[model samples]
Structure formats: structure tokens, C-alpha cells
Target: MIKRLICAAVFSGTIATNVNAEELRFTVWTGSKAHLDMLNDIANGFKQTHPDVTVRYDTIPFGDYVQKLTLQMAGGNPPDLGWLLENSAPAFVEAGALADVSKTLHATENYNYADFSTSAMGLWTKDDSVYGIPFSTSPFLVYYNKSLYDAAGLETPDQRATDGTWTWEQLKKDAATLRNADAGVWGYETVDGQGYSARVWHNLIPIIRAYGGNAWTDGTCHLDSPEAVKAIKLFHNMIYVDGSAVPPGEQGDFFSGKSALTVTQISRVSKLADANFDWGIAPLPAGPAGNAATVGQAAVVAFAQGKNKEIAAEFLAYMTSAKNVAKMAEFFPPARKSVLEGDAFLSSNPAITPAQMKIVAQGIENGSVLPSHEHFPQIEAKARPEFDALWSKDADIQATMTKLCQGIQPLL
Candidate 1:
């Protein structure tokens, strides 16, 4: 009986030791094997200091990330660390759902917090509290099929960009020429072909900005502004009138050689590793407002409800250090000023030419991030049906813009 009691004590001690060595749960939207491998490598580095802590990265779909994360928070199972999109930053911060990680960042040795650009850190900070660190500051660019341009007997977008002739009006004409229904070739495709619905704002913001408009400013909706309306009309004409761009319910993928052009970030060049056709990237065409580069940003945040909030903050600091930021720049553009302007960033991706990378580097330096609001998810929910109404022919451009503004105004 005495020996049994001693065994019981040993077992209890083992259980307690195991409980002390915790595994941190992290959530990310990417399911790609390559991406996960890189992330796991970074997580492995934590062992240098935290020998017993393990991090598990859970993959959440981009469209449902915020919704599902909120559910986890409600269930008291929130991840220790997660990737937050810019639009959700304000809502998350305002809800007190994210831990204030400024102290951890400030205390980290050799972290170099000031290396992050002032503009890049704007949305993640509120006065004295810092909630997150921006990981991706990717700017939108036009990826064009060089073969299609050659077949269409027209100069490529990069050529036009250099000649100062790459305007939205010129794109409309070029797209019309490149489109061939008989050949099953489309002139343009929006981000992943979900633009009209799941990615409505992502699809239109670049053109809207190029035309000198924004979703809102100072608590007012601007979708109905003259510039915004004009920009939407041009895209409408491409889908319905010119029949160049792939419209709602249709599919045309540029990487598959079925589409001539697409507007996304440089990271997507990974999709062209085995391309059968030639491709090149160029800055988004200029509009009446001149060159208006647009960026989409995501950040690393530690949840306020995490079981190990302090440890999560320490890991966040390590992952966003200049060294790790440069490592991640191969897939996700870094927001660090030192990395963004360095030669390492220029040659980070083997798939892209140095000149093409220059376009990306320039856009990061001179672009505006997509519009973000505290109530963005609510605004998107309300604006859904209104935006759907614009996909049809004979859709009154001015009237639709007014209705869209009306739908999202209350949420604004």
C-alpha cells in the first residue's frame, strides 16, 4: 500500500509538469504547405528561449476568419496568437479583445521597434497602446499575360506605364481588344474571381482610389461621390458593355492562361512557377487622380483572452523582428522600413525580376492601405445586396452608388 502511494505521487508530479509546459494555439488563414512550413520553422525558433513551449497554427478560411475567431473568443477558447486583417483591427482593439503588447515589444532585446514605418504601424496603434504588428503591406498590381499582348498586337501594360500612357481609359480599350469569346480568353479577372461578392471592396478600392475617392472619411460614406461613381461605372462597362472582364458568376483565371490580366499582389506570382505562357506585372493604371497605389495589410496579434498572454506577446515580438520580417518577405511583404528598402527584399523572390520587384517596392512606399473601420464587417453585411445590384446590365450607376452609400452609412 505504501509503494502504491509513492507511485501515485510520482504520476501526479508528471501530470503537473506536463501541465506547466503549455502549447500555444495560433490561428492563420493560409493553408498552403509552403507557408505552414515556414511558419513552423519560425515557431521552432522559440525553443531557444522557451524549450518546452510548442505552437500549433490553425488554418481558418479568410472569409470566415473574423467570425470564427469571435466565436472562439465567446467560447473562452481564443487562440494565443492570430493574424488579423486591417479592417478587423479597429473592431478587435475597440472590443478589448487584443492584448496590449507594447510593453513586451519595448522590452524585447534587439527587436528594433522603430524600424517599422510610422505609416505601417498607424492602424495597429491607438494613442499609447499597441495591439499588433503589421506583417503584410502588399500593394495591388496588374499581372498581364505577355503572350496575349503580343497576340493582340498591343504594347504591354509595363510598356504603356513607362510611356506615360497607362490610364484606366487605355486599359478599357486594351481589354476590349484582348478579349476573345471564341478563344475562351478573358481580358481581366478580379482577385480570385470572388470580387463581385466575397471580395467586393477589394475588387473596387484600387479603381476608386485611383479616381480620388475613398469608402468613407470623417464618419461619412463616400461611395456615392462623383469620383467613386465614375470609377465604378468604368468597371461596370468592362463587365457588361465591353464584355472584356469576367463578370459575376463567370470564371477566368490568369494563371491558367485563360485570362489576359489580373490585379493582385506580387506574392501571387508563386502561382506561376510552371507557367506555360509568359507573364509580367505592372503598377495599377493611372486614373484622373494620377497614380493611386492601393495596399492590403494584415498583422500579428496576441489575444487578450489567451491562456499565456505574456508568452504570446513575447513570441509576437520575435516573429516580427527585422530578421524574421526579412525571412517572411519572400512570401508576405514586410512592413519594416529597413527590409522594404534593402536589396534582400528586391531579390527575395526567385520568380520575379528585379525590375518587377521595383514596382512592388515603390507601391509599398507610396500606396494607401484599403479602408478599414471599426464596424467594417457590419458595413460589408449591409452593403452585400446593394453591391450585387450593380452586376447587371442597365444598372443605373449613379443610383446604385447612392444606394450602396445608404446601405453602409448607418454602419459607418
Candidate 2:
């Protein structure tokens, strides 16, 4: 009888262990084969440590990611883990749709909240509490075609890094010198639209900060200042007055080898690598504020509505780990110190060396994130028309910004 009881207890324990080892489902909105392969490798590694646990990965097209994710959440079934951009987190968080991982995230010894870029962490924090682990983050960088600079007899921006001489004024002057109309190449081309508008914002904010204009104060809009007006005027000048940039409508032509320089995110490096021109990346131009800052975007967050909260959190933790993060960093730069300093990340990408990565790291540390206000989308919608008008020289800068801010104020 005693032997039978012991055997029964052991059998039940084994069954419980098997039950605990079930597969977890994960969903991501955007990634490449290399990204998915790295995720699979991380899952395999996780399985090795916890033999009973399995991970299932799913991907959604970037175009329909939000709509599909919303439908899935409404359908009473959601993945164990998923991706969330920082600017888009408030709506879901306000709806009480994300699992609170404050306790789990804080309790982990390897997790250092301070190690993440402030912009990345700000997206997940609400009322002084953190809700997500940032997986990927990037700051805007100024990429120049080295060959163009050499041909123009213009000095490289990188050479000015130590002296802090690479200011916006200098960039504008250099761009003018490099412009070649006969060859159909302009000094620069950057879009001002829904997503690409970020590039404009990234370039503008530093100027605003330099001019001592603040975007917000204690969650309130403070963009209606003289300094802000000056910054906007500078942008208008870039597009219409100085003609440094291709006109808004003809901007696409620039990407087709018609622009001598472009200021965009580091991610564009991969695409530009295949371009017929020789190019190199550099930090953004300095502003009057005595500092250069870039806007960091695209942070990963876990949804509150996920079915397998615990398992999803575990997967998120694994995804942010040094090894896995380093792999992901090959595509999207890592947001943590461990991965940033790890050999895997430091040695993986030959295109961006550790030194170049350090410049990006510094940018994130000193930069800011787009605010997560409920009215942000509304503000963006209203501002677009005004910005377009200003860029086209159809309206005065001050009047346009004033009207733009007024239109967005009611929504806020």
C-alpha cells in the first residue's frame, strides 16, 4: 500500500510538469527572415532551459498590424505576446488592455530599468510605473554620400564630431555647395507625412530645444512660442526659401539618386547600402541649444489582453535578454546595455561599427520620445495640412503654427 501511494504521487507530479510545458503563442507585426530565425533560435534556447515550454511565432503584415491586432483582441483570443509602438500604447493602456508586468519586470535582477534609453522607457511608464520592456529603439542620424562630399570639396560631418562644429547652419551651407541641378541632385530630401514626418520632427525638435522652446510642460502643450515659430521658419526655409531640399511634391525623386544628402533613421542604412552611391552615416547637426538630439521611436510592449500573460512576459524577457537582443540588434538596434556591450552585437554588423553604435547610443540617451497623449493622432492630423501649406509657401509660418495649435488644442 505504501509503495502504491508513493508511485501515485510521483505519477501525478510528472503529469503536472508535462501540463506546464505547453507551447506559447507569440505575434509580431513586422520583421524579416533573419529576425524570425533569431527568434526561433531564442525559443529553442528557452526550451532547453525549460524543456516543457514551447513557443509558437506568428507574424502580421505591417500595413494591417493594428487593425488585425484589434480584431484579435476583440475576438476573445489574443496571442501570448505581441508588439506595441510607444506612441500607440496609451489607447490600449487606458482601456486596461495590457497586463501589468510591473512586479515581474522589477523583480528580475538582470533587468535594469536605468540601462534603457529614457525615450524608450518613457513609452511604457504611466503615473510613475513601468509597464513594458523595450526591445528595439533607434535615433535619427544624418547619412551623407561620401562621394558627393568629396566631389563638392566639402568637409565630412564626422570630422566635426569632436569640435561640435556640425551645426544646422553649417549643414545648410554644405548642402548648397553640393547641389548639382544638371545632374538632378539636390542637397537633401526628407518627407513630411504620417510616418516620414518623424524625420522632420527629429530634425526640428533639436532646433526648437536649441532656441529654448519646449514642446510640452507637465503634459501640457507649450509649442506656441516665438522660438517654436523660428524653428518652423527654418524648416520652411529649408524646403522653399533656401531650396536646400527638393519641393515636397518632388521629394520621392531624391531617393532615386537625385539627392546628395538625406537625414533619416539608422534603419535606412540597409536600403542605402544597395544604392549606386557611396554613403556614410553621421550624428545629427547641433542646434543653438548647445546640444544635438534625435527622436527615438519604435519600442516593444506586451499587450494587456494577451491570453498567456505569464508565458508572454517570459517570452518578452527572453526576447530582451543579451543573447537574443544582440541578434535582434542586427536588424533593430538593442535598447539595453547588456546587448549594446555584448560581443554578439558589437561584432555582428560590419556596416555599423561599435564606434558608430556608440554615437547612436549617446543620441538615444540625450534625445526624447514622442509624447503619448490621447490627442496625439488628432494633433498630427491637423498639423499635417498646416505643415504642408507652410512648406509650399502658401501660408506664413507664425499664422500656420498658430492655426495648427488651435486646431489641435480642442482635441487635447
Best by lDDT: 1
Candidate 1: give the clashing pairs: none
Write candidate 1's Cα lDDT for 1-412 as tens digits.
2122222332332211222327878899888776888889999988788987889999998777777777666644668899998888887777667789999999999899999878899989998899999989998899999998997789999999999999888888888899989989999898877789767888899899889888899999999999999999999999988999998888899999988988888767778888999999999999999999888899999977677888889899989999888888888888999998999888998888888889998888888989988777678777888898898898987898899898888877
Residue 174, candidate 1: Cα error in Å is 2.0
* Weakest ten-residue segment in model 2 by summed lDDT: 11-20
In candidate 2, stretches whose alpha carbon ends up further than 4 angstroms from where it belongs are 1-40, 47-80, 103-120, 126-130, 191-200, 251-256, 341-348, 410-412
lDDT for model 2, please: 0.64
Q: Write the per-residue lDDT of candidate 2 for residues 1-412, one digit (tens) a residue.
A: 2122222332332211222237676777645565677778889988886687888777987545655665655544555667776555665555555667766666666766577756556667787665677776766677777888888777888777667788777877777787777777888766322223434455566567766676666655556678888766666676667777676556434345677766666655555545776777677777666665655556455555554567667767766766676777776767787676666765566677777777777776676664556445456556667666666565577777677777767756
Identify the runs in model 1 with alpha carbons over 4 angstroms from their true place. 1-21
By TM-score, how accurate is candidate 1? Answer: 0.92
lDDT of each: 0.85, 0.64
